[model samples]
Every structure is written in structure tokens, then in C-alpha cells.
Target: MAQARENAVSEAPYYQGLAKSMMFTIALVSLAPLLGYALLSGYQYTTAYKEKVEAHLRELVLKHDQSVDSYLREKVAEVQVLGEVVGGDRLKAEAEITSLHNALVRSHGSDFVDLGIVNAAGVQVAYAGPYPLQGADYSNAEWFQAVKRRRVFVSDVIFGLRGVPHFIIALLVDVGGEQWVLKATLDFMAINDLVEDIRIGETGLAFITNRAAQFQTTPRRDMTGEVKLLHNILARGGEDSILGRGRAAITVVDDPVTGREVLFVTSPLKDGEWFMVYQQDTADAFAALYRIRNVGVAVLLLGTVCILAMAFLLSRRMARKVEVADQEKDMMNDQVVEAGKLASVGELAAGIAHEINNPVAIMVEEAGWVQDLLEEGLQKDDNEREVQRALTQIRSQGARCREITHKLLSFARKIDPTVERMCVNDLIREMAQFCEQRAKYANVRIETSLEDGVPQVEASQSEMQQVLLNLINNAIDAMDPGGGELDIMSRAEGGDVFISISDTGCGIPKANLQRIFDPFFTTKPVGKGTGLGLSIIYGIINKMGGDISVKSVVNKGTAFTIRLPASKEGMRCAAGNGAAGEQPPADGGRSEETGG
Candidate 1:
């Protein structure tokens, strides 16, 4: 019969495939949410950081704007006090106006570089300190025009008679219906100090620009009072919507002066004519953001690794379970195949036994009848003695044939076991006699140790005999090509009878120890083993409520031990019969032969 090979302890490919699939699923499930959370959190944190910077920049710009307003107010108020106290008509008296200008210069040396009194026609009527012009033309000048119209004006930085960059705070005074302008030149040193002191980062910058897109406070010392033409920073989207609209706003864009990516925050002065711009390198401003993003990435990667590790371990465990289940299923299939073979063999043996039984019986009767007739008809010695001896040989051979037929019948399913209490040691000794000739032929020794007090076991007498005979035959065969000792041992312990059959032969390997009981699994050469000897013995012992185990060492020896209940009380209860006896039937049927 064709049979499939059984595997009990190997990993299968399908199991690994399933584990891989499970790991993928787990990784996706775990990593998706982690990535999303990282992205969202990073974005929100960066946005908050930018907003905080914008708020701080606004506060700084507003404080600087207030300081600038106070400084200009103080200078302009001084000019007003001078114009009012020393009237414009008094300023026509050169001596008196010159005395007042000298006193002002002494009081405010850093702020009042020079003072000039100009008439409505823009001509300097009187001047003091530094300039030789007593009547310099002031008509058509931008400051003169602004003063005439607005009565007060703060001009952009310019280089006039002084030939140095400075601004003029002019006050318009009307005395006796004539307008005269008092103008004072103020340098931008104070404003520059304030802008420079506003600390941001290593690459941070601060500068002021006017409404006309002209730089009021120069961003760099080389570009002082020279930066004029520039685009409005706040009105990027639309000219009308965002221009000078926001009190303070922050943006990330390329800097016009540095031509590098920067974070620029604009805080328009309350006057609306000028604005303070704060610039920080984008890398510096958002460095915290980059750190946060890096942390998020690290956390996500770590979580993914942990999840994948868990998935791998869980999948491996599941794969092991699948492997074990497959091995069990294969073992079951092997058992089924073995059972079918046993059934078929039993039926064939029964049929053959029945066919040969009648002819063997007839031969035995005929041989006896000839021996009796020869003894009654023949006289004296002569041919009668030879005839009697021949008849006796025929009867003996016929009886041996009958015994063989009975042995085959015993293997048939139709024959039920008759459980009886029988001495295990006696059975072992009786079975060994059959193997003694074979041992002698091979020059092997048979040694036995039967404990004197070993109890009898309740079992099928014929089956027990067959079990011992099979074990002994296998032990003999294992020592092939050489002679070895076969050791048979019997003892009673714990109300159980134990029989150990051992041989000094090439032993079974450790790897195949468990598989030795499996049907058709044998290490013997082809045609030398049917591989069913041990399997059949296992089944028979289990049916009789006994246990069997084996131990072996390579190139040294192998041993098999069987355990059977030896108590008469337990046996009587187990078999439901009172068949404990010291002897078996007189037929002494031969055992069904099996190979190892």
C-alpha cells in the first residue's frame, strides 16, 4: 500500500507565510496612528513657536516706538519753548537770539548740533553755532514747506549745511501775523542705539522703515541713511488689504537685504509713518521646531520597531502551534494506515490457515493408521522397524504443520483473547527456547534473570508469548554480522510485573527514538524489515492495559521494557473473570511470527 511519510517536529513553509502576513498587518495597525500624531503635533508646535516670536517682537517694537516718540517730543518741545520765550521779533535782534542759541547748545550739546531761524519765505533770518550763513535761502526746501503747512514737522535724515546725516524737528511760530520756523538738527545716534540693543538671536536684526518704503534707521552701518527704495513687507497678498493694516505680523520669506530665508516680523509705529522690522534667520527661529520633529521621528521609528518585534514573536508562537498540530495529524494518519494493513493481513492469514488445516489433519490420521497396520500385520524385525520409524516421522511433521496453522489462526480477528493470570517469567523462558537455535547459529549468548517472587500478570497468554518472541527475534537480528548477548529480565514491583529485553547490538538513534513505534518506520535494510513488529507489539500491550518504553545507546545496546498489572485482585476486577491459572492449553500453539 502507498503511504504518506509523517513529520512530527519540523517547521513548515505555510506557517512562516502566515506569520509574515500577520506581522505586516500589525505593523500597519500600530504605525499609522503614530505617524499621524507625530505630524500633527509637530505642525502645531512650530506654529505656536512662530506665534510666540511674533508676540515678543511686537512688544519690543512697540517699546522702541514709544521711546522714539518721547525723544522726538522732548526735542520738539525744547524747540517750541525756545521759539516762544525768545520771540521771532526778538530773533531779529541778532545779539539776543545768538545769546539764546548759545545757552541752548550749552544745555543740550549732544542733541542741538545747530539752531536756525527761518522766515516765511524759507530764508534763514538768523543762525547760531557752526554755520557762517546769516541769511541762507530756505525757500522751496522740503522742511520749510512742511513747517509752513503743518506748523510742526520731523524731516527724514538728510545732509544739509552740516554735510552729516541728521534729521530736523521744525516748529512754526507766528508773531504779529508773521510766520517764522525754528528748526533743530538731531543725529540718529540715539535711535540707532535703541535698535541695536533689541536682542533676538545670533543672526537677528532690527531696522526702521518709513511709509514711503524708505529706510529711516539703516539696517547696516554702510547703508546708513541710504536705503530708500523697497517693497512693503506686509502687503504681500494684496496692496490694499494688508498694507500697514496689521499692527504686528510675522512671516517667513527670503530677506531682501541678506537674500536668505528669514523669519521677519513687522511692528508698525503708532504714527503709521514708520515701522520697525525684526529679522531672524529661519534656521535659528525654528530650531526648536526641528528638534521636536526629530524627536517625533525617533519615537515613531522606535514604536514601529517594538511593534514589529512583538508581531514577530507572536507569529512565531502561532507557527509553532500550527507545526505541532500538523505533526499530530500526520501521526493519526499513519495509525490509520497501519490499522488497515493489520486488518488485511489478519484476514489473509486466517484464510490460509483454514485452507491448510484439513489436509494436515488428514495426513496425521493416515500416518497413524499405517503405523498401526504395520505393527499388526508385519512379523519380526526386518522392514517393519524402518516402516514404523518412517510413519512416526510423518506424524511428527504433520503435528508441526497443525501447530503452524493454529498460530496463523490466532492472528485472525475472529479469535478473541482469553485473559488469564500467567507467570511472566515462565512465558519469557518458554519464548527464549524458540530463539536459542538462532542465537547459537550466530554465536550469540542468551542470558536471563527471573526474579523468584515475580507475580503473574493477567493477560492473553498467546499474545504475551508473541510479544516476547517478537522482542527476542528483533534483539537477535540487531546483532547482525556479529555475536552479542540477549538479556531477558523479569521482576515484580508496585503490584506490577516488569519485563526488560535488552541486546548488545547497534542501537537506535536518539533522533528516531519516538518514531520507532510508528508503522513502517524502520532503520533496517530493505526486504529485511516489514517495520510492523514493534507497532503490533505496542498495540497488543496497550490492549492488555500495559505500558512499554525503550532506551538505547549508539553502537552499544538497546533495551525495551514492558509493564503489566500483577495483582490478582486488580486483574480479576479488570478482566471480570476468575481465570488465574499456572498452565496454558496443551495445544501449545506457535506464535504469529513478526520481523523487527
Candidate 2:
């Protein structure tokens, strides 16, 4: 992944040039209608905000419709089953309704207002549930009449014989020319419960309406619980929206009866038989903009024009600045080349250090084990004992040489490599231990709070360690006397782990904090830094699928939080402060995929 290439693109003409000015003028002139149209559309939709409340209300209505349809269809299906069971005996039909009506009430709850059945004669022979309409003649009802002729019908909301707000769902039951009308009446109260989920602010109402503007559901605001409607415009045979059409006309109107001005937003629903109308108080919708008064509209339009003009002016100004920027960019490129040259030299330095240190580390561990065996009386021969003693000294010197090499390689590009899954907590702890002598010399104390079960992450061990150590060293260096603390902590989050390192030393200046991560950016005096430490650390952390953000208050301290992707392959690398941040050398380092 060559990042340099990601930013490479063909240049465009500068905005201050005559050609750019002409382009801008043309664009601004050509775009006024588009801007106006966008604003108008936004204004129309946004006016519906409080009314719709959320998308869930619309879904609830559709879902309730489906459920009701299914329930009625189930009853129609049962008619066939019951006809088979009774075999044309009207006497058994009443007894069957008694049993099934009780079952329906128990299953569907008290929401149902009426459950009744009629014989082929269309007289309600048996009825159950609250508001019993027994002995009533639903046989001539619109839904009943339709069902008598073998059609399923869902009649519009009406007051049943029980005088309850309910709708009739009926279907025909035929067995060998004998027939009956099976009907279910549902209370309008159920829809009130559905509408209750919508929230309306002060002086606002939430309600539903049919395509013809008949009320279907609304908030139970009044005690009467009556089915109310905008009755003036609702006509059974008046103008209706065409089917398959959506977003019909919306208007602010007085209900003529209620005399309330309402902003209505309607969506075609149930195949245009109805429209889901979400209405709110028109007064409340414009309440927020009241502070503007009569001059508001004029000011808004003027401000919009001024802002666009200012933007064009800003672009024109930037064209002049681009030339100066181009010069600075070239200077920066020269610096990059210079840095690359230094890096080439650092590579050689790194090669020498690594080649000299690897064998030394192995020898040191081997000799330590051998010396332990000798002390445990494993070696009997005096020559062997003498040889082991000599090897011990050689191993100690070799280990010292390895430490020297590590110190030399610390400032090299090969030192702080890229990241992989590693135990971040342990890595920070090792840096604390490694910097112990440095901290003592600088008279600073390092503390740690490594959270348990913190997941390992793909990160650069050396880079993160160097970052902590650098920040800690910076703090130690910043302190006047002795009392200061460098605290490091690591904790696991969802798919990432956060490592925070804070210092109790004097805080950074507000002006410098933002630029602290920039390349060669430092607040330290001459000879104290190359200033690439934090910059390199920043680059490495970002490259490792992680981010580092610093928060500081003057007179307090700075805390740097590094978030990394959790994974496991970098565990050993993190523990050893290995070259985990950089790509492995073409022939020298190992490669493996880590489990995240």
C-alpha cells in the first residue's frame, strides 16, 4: 500500500484565475433554480417532521392491517370446518358458537367487541363477547349481504347494534346450498393503541385518515373515545386519489367543523383505499422560527446570497495562495528526499545492529541456562566448569553488545515497525521497565493500570513502545524536580483496544498541542530532539489500523489515547518490542497472519 500514490491526482485550474472566475459566475447563475428547488422540497418534507414522528407508525398500521386480514380469513376458513362437523344441523351451530366464541375471546383478548354468526337466513342466531348483539339482524348489513352471496367483505367503521365503534368483517359459509354469514366486529380502540406510540408536542395532534379524508385512528385525547373525522370533506363518492399514486396533495385547512389549522402529510396506503395522514398543529411547526418576526424571510435570503458570494471570494483568494503553497510543497519534497537519504543510511545502521545482536541474545540465554546447570552440580569435569564460566562472561558481554545495538537502532527507521495482534498492556509494561533506569536518572515515576482480558491487537509493538517511552521521557524531561508520574493503561473495547499514556508533568501549551504530531514538530530545545518521535508514532499508529488522539489542559497534563484493532499474532513481537510496525525486511523477518 503506497500511501503517496493515494494522494496523487491531476491538478485543476486555480480559482482566482480569469477562467475560474468566469466558471464560478456561470455556475452560480446556472444553479439558482436547483438551489431553490432543493430548499422548497426540503421545506415541504421538513414540515411533516413532528407529524410523522417516526417510520414505525406507518409500519405498525400495515402490520395491523395484515394481522386483521389474516384473523378474518381464519374465521372464514373455520366456517368450512364447522359446516363439515355439524352437517346441516342449525341446532348445533349455536352450541358451536358458544364454544368457539369463548376460545376467540381467550386467544385474542378483550379488544374484540363482537363475535357473532348468522344462519342461512342471515339472522344473528348466536353472539358472544362484550356488547352482545344477540337476536340482531346483521344479515342485511352491507358486509353480511356481501358474504351471503359468497364474498368476503370488510365494512367501513360503523356503530354496531351494541353501539360500539367497530368494523364488520364478514364472509359466506355454504354447505350443500344451505348458507350462513360469519362476521367478526373489531373495536376501533385497537387502532388508538397503535397511534399512541407517536409523540405530539404541545398543541399538536396525531391522527390517521382515509384517502377520502375520513378519520380511521387518532390519539385518545378526549374521554368520549368516539370515532371522529374531518367530516366536511369526507364523501363516499367525491373526488378520490387515483390508485398506485403516492404523495397526494397536502394543504393547511380548517376542518370546517373543528376550525383548527393543521399541516397534513399523507401517504397512500392499503392500495389507495386509504391514506395514512399524520397531521400536526400548523402553529407549532413554525414556532421555532418565530424569533425572526416579519424581517426574517428577507434576512434569510440576503444571508444565503452573501454566504455564497463569500465562498466564491474565498475560492478566488485561495488561487493566489496556491502559488505560495506550490513553492512550499516543493521545499517539503526536498526535505522528504533528504529524509529518505538519511533513512538509507539508517538501514545500514540497522542491518549492522540486528546482525550483531541476534546471536548475542541467543548466547546470553544459553549461557544463563548453562550457568544455572553448573550451579546445580550438573557438571563434574573442572575443564567443563571453567569453559562454562568463560562462556558466561562472553554471554554477558554479548548481551551488553546487544543492548548497545538496540540503543543505536532506536532512532532508525527499521526500529519502529508496523503493527500486528499484540498484548498492548504487556508492551507498555515492558516499556515502563525498560525506561526504569532512564526514569530514575530523570527522577520520574512510571505507573501502569493494565486491564485484565484486554484483547490483543494488530499494532506496531516497537512504534507503540517508542511512543510511550518518548512521551514518558518527554514528561520526565519536562519536570523541574522529582514529583511527576507517567501512567500507562490499556483496555479492550468492542473490536479495538485503547492504550492511554498520561503524564503528571507540566502540560503542553495550547497553541502547540495541535501541531505536536506534525513531522519534525517539537517544543523541545536544540540537542533535545529531532522532533520526528511523535510524528513517526502518529504515522505508525494510523498505518496500523488505529488512531491516536491527544487531550491536554495547560497546567494539568497530556493524555494520548491509541486505539488499535485486536488480534494475536503480534503477541511475541509486542512483548519483545520487536519490529512490528514496519514491513518485514524482504529476506530477514518472519511473516504470519494473526487471529483477531
Candidate 3:
């Protein structure tokens, strides 16, 4: 018991290691492809989604850039047309300017906030609409100086004399050899509406800024904290620096104030004097991509959980089965030891038989001499007749002892493993009679019901002997302490020979029936059973193309049935050798029963 415990403890680590190895193998195989696909697909989708968003933002910024530029150019052209048609001489008149402004307002709505005429000295010479100053000073104004050098000029948004945020379009005119500036203030709210309408998802909005980083139009969101960041972006000198370029560019940067990554799409406007930029938070722009990524991670996590669970369960189960098989193997090794002992006992029996043979021969010769002496003294006397009878009895008993010694030597000799065709009924009768002495000692009854025409089987004689002996011994052991009947039967049916050995003994339980033939499985007490007998028998029969089965009822009896294919060659040999005898009566051949 202690040794068994030690062996079990030693094997625990081996089984645990096996289980762990299996678990890791299963997990790696299952998760490799899943993780690879998720990562690969995620990378591809992110790249595509980001490119799509950048393209869309770039297109949006460019479209609005054209609209804002067109609005500025149209205002400049209107001012230039007024200067040319009204002739700077008439423009000197305040009434003529007022009538022209009213006509322009009637034609273009409030987009034309007000109109004015400024001389080369930067002083307003004529004014129209809203403000009261007809001669507002303009000598120091930036537009006055710019207009003197350019035919048309669009100014950045500034709080001018009106103290309101607005920009103006001015056209220079030559009136009687004098330079005159025709200026019209554009409605700041009108241009601001153009940029305000360029809204996208949450946190996405557009605004316009000049090269000086001054806001030219109102932004939809607060821009107080982003002024420095915008200036730095305008100062950049790469493809995304669109300050003086005609094409739009895109960039992504971290917002210093919001501490979030932002996407910027910038386009040149108003002859590169201003920039139309559309900025949006990157998270908001790619919200759908992030959502899909989140869902994929969730699914991957769930798959990992399931894979681990199955791996653990299957590995543990397989490991348990392996442990059981190993234990059975150890038990089979013990049975091999038991078989070795039996072989030694057979050798001892052979030695005894050799010794007894000589003695029995000498005794038979001496008894023959005594009988001859009695015969020589043959007389019609009672003494002489008694001597003759006694001598006769001694000779007959000596012959019986010699015969038993010869049979013992034959049985104890080494077995031959050569395969041969042999009659099944003959082997059955031999094995039954061999066990008759043991049965008698146990007060058991032995019976035989063999069909006369049972066909011969082809198999190794020694293996067949072992199979029958083991089965008979098991039956005898089952009936120990209380003798029982042992029945042996043989029949030829369906091209096969059937043999059955039954015993009225303590039978096997239903639960153990299926495992009875398994190596190392036994209900017998420890030393009394090695548990390999039935398994070896099963294997031998299977090797000869035969099969065995069993049936039992607990507390009643057990029956083992064997089926072997009948040999056609053996049948032909029997016929050629004239060994085929007359068939028995139709009542199922011969039956015999003998009490121990």
C-alpha cells in the first residue's frame, strides 16, 4: 500500500505537465489566426478610413475657398465699375454718390454695407449710407496706401473708423491726372455666414485667417486659446503650408488647449492674403472607425475566453485517461511476474516426474516377479490364492503409478507454439479431464456437452492451452470455499466452432462485466489474482481470428463463450486421413456429467 501511494504521488507531476502542454498547444493553435486577422483587418480599415476623411475635408475647404474669393472679387469689380461709369468728376458730388449707393444696395442687398470715395491723400471726399461723416480722414489708412499701388485691393478684416469689424474692397481710379480711391465696406456678417455654414460632425467647424494670423471671419467655436497654434501652423514650410499656395492641404496636430488631436484642412483664399481652414477633432471625424475597433476587441476577448475554457477542459480529461492507462500498465507488469512463477512451478513438476518414473518402473518389475512366484506355487490352497491376488493387486497399482508419472512429465514439458489444425472437442475433453482432480478436491461437478461433428480450428496449440487453462482456473477459483458445477460445451455453427465454459459460482457484477477482460482489472483479492489471465486469453483468441464474450448474473453464475473460424484445410485433411467418424444422433451429439 505504501509503495502504491509513492507511485501515485510520483506520477502526479507527469500528468500535470502533460495537461499543461496540451492546454498551451490548443490555445496557441486556436488564437493565432484569430488575433492575426483582427490586427490585420484593423490596420487596413484604419488606413482607408483616415484617407477618406482627409479627402472629404480637403474637398470641403477648397469649395468654400472659391466662394469666399468670388465674393471679394465681385465686390471689387462693382466698385471699379462705379468709378468708371460715374466718372471721378461726378463721384466728387455727395448726392451722386448717395444715389449710386442706393442703387447698389437695391441691386445687391445688405452685402454692401456702405460706400465712400477717398482721395489720394487718404481723406474720404464723398460718402453714402449710414455714417454721418462725408469727409472722414483716410491719409493714414492701409487701404489708401495699398490702392495707390494696385488697381484693386481687398483688405483684411479690421475695425476701421466705424469701430466695427469689417473689410473693404477698393479700386484706384485716375480722375483728371489725380489718383482717387473708390472704397466699399463689405458686410462682415455676410462673409462670416459663408464660413459658419461649413460645419461637419460635432467639434468640426471652419474659419478664415490672414497671413498675420488675424481672424477674417467669425468661427463657430471659441478660438481664443488656439491663436498661437494657428500662427505656428501658418508659419510651417511644408506641403501643408497653404498661406501663399493656390491648392488645399491637410494636416493633423495636437491641440494645445484641448489636448486632443485635431485634423486641419487649409486652402488659400483672397489671392493668398487669407486662409480658409476647416478643423475638426480627429476622434469625432473617425468616430465610426473607433466604434468598429472597439467591437472587434470585444469579440476577440470573448473568443479568447472560450478557447481557454475548452483547452483547459479537454486537456484535463485527456490527461486523466492517460493516467488511468499508465496504472493499468503497472498492474500488467505484476501479472507477468505471476506468470514467471507459474513457469518455475512447471519446471519443478517436470523434475519430480523424472524422479518418480524410474521408481515406478522398478516397482512394476518387482511386482511382476512376485506374481510369477505366486503362479509357480499355484495350488488349490487358500494361502497360495491370497498371495497370487495380493501380487496381482501390487502389479496393477504399480502400472497405474507409472502412467500418472508419464502424464505429469508430458504436461510439465515446455509447450510448443507452432500453429496446427486440431479438433475442438478433443481439446475440450482433455482440458476437462485434466482439471477433474482439482474439481474432485473441491467437491465440484464437471460436465461436457460436445457436438460430435464440431469442426477443427487452426491456432497455436500452446496459446490455446493457455487460454483454456486460465479460464478453467478462474472458474474454479470463483467457486472456492463452496463447490459448484463446471460445464464445458462445443458446437459447429455458421462455419465457426463455438466453445463455452460456465460455472455456478459467485458471478461478476454488471458494472464490472464490460471491464473484466481489461488488463489489470480484477475483483479477486490482491495476491490471489494478477488480473492478466483473461486479458491474455482475449489477446490469444483475437490473434487466431477469434473472439470471446461473457454473460453473468450476480450470485448465480458466469458463462464465457468463444468463437473460432473452422479450418477448411483441416476438414479436408480429416476426410483424406479417413478420420471422419459417423455422425451422432440428431439430439445434439454426446453429453456427460461427473461428480467430483
Taken over the whole model, the C-alpha lDDT of each candidate is 0.70, 0.58, 0.78
Please write out the lDDT profile of model 2 over residues 1-596, one tens digit for every residue. 24333423223443246437754775576457656865685566555653454343344444544454455456446544544454444522566666766766677676555566677766877776665567777656667766655466666666756566777667565544667666666677665565555555565544555544556665446412222443333332124444322443344565444566765544544445555555556666555533333245566567667767775666666665675587578567446534533543443354445555666766767677676667867556564766567687776767656554553344333243344456666556655665555566567777777777777776555556556656666666666466577777777788788888888767788899889988778776785466776776676677677888988877677788988887744332233333222222221221122221
Q: Mark the regions of model 3 whose C-alpha exceeds 4 Å error after superposition.
A: 237-246, 332-596
Task: Quote each prediction's TM-score.
Answer: 0.55, 0.35, 0.61
Error at 249, model 3, angstroms: 1.4
| Candidate 2: regions farther than 4 A off | 1-92, 130-133, 208-240, 243-249, 254-260, 267-275, 286-596
User: Compared to the true structure, candidate 3 yields what TM-score?
Assistant: 0.61
Error of 1 at 517 (Å): 24
lDDT of 1 by residue, 314-374 (tens): 8788777777787686567556535544543553454455546655766677677666767
Model 1 residue 291 CA deviation (Å) reads 2.7
Q: Is candidate 2 or candidate 3 better by lDDT?
A: 3
Q: Which ten residues in a row have the lowest lDDT in candidate 2?
A: 587-596
**Which whole-number lDDT from 0 to 100 does residue 166 have in model 1?**
79
How many clashing residue pairs appear in each of the predictions shown? 2, 13, 2
Worst 10 residues of 1 by lDDT: 572-581
Off by over 4 Å in 1: 1-16, 93-109, 131-134, 220-230, 234-244, 256-259, 302-596
- The prediction achieving the highest TM-score against the true structure is 3
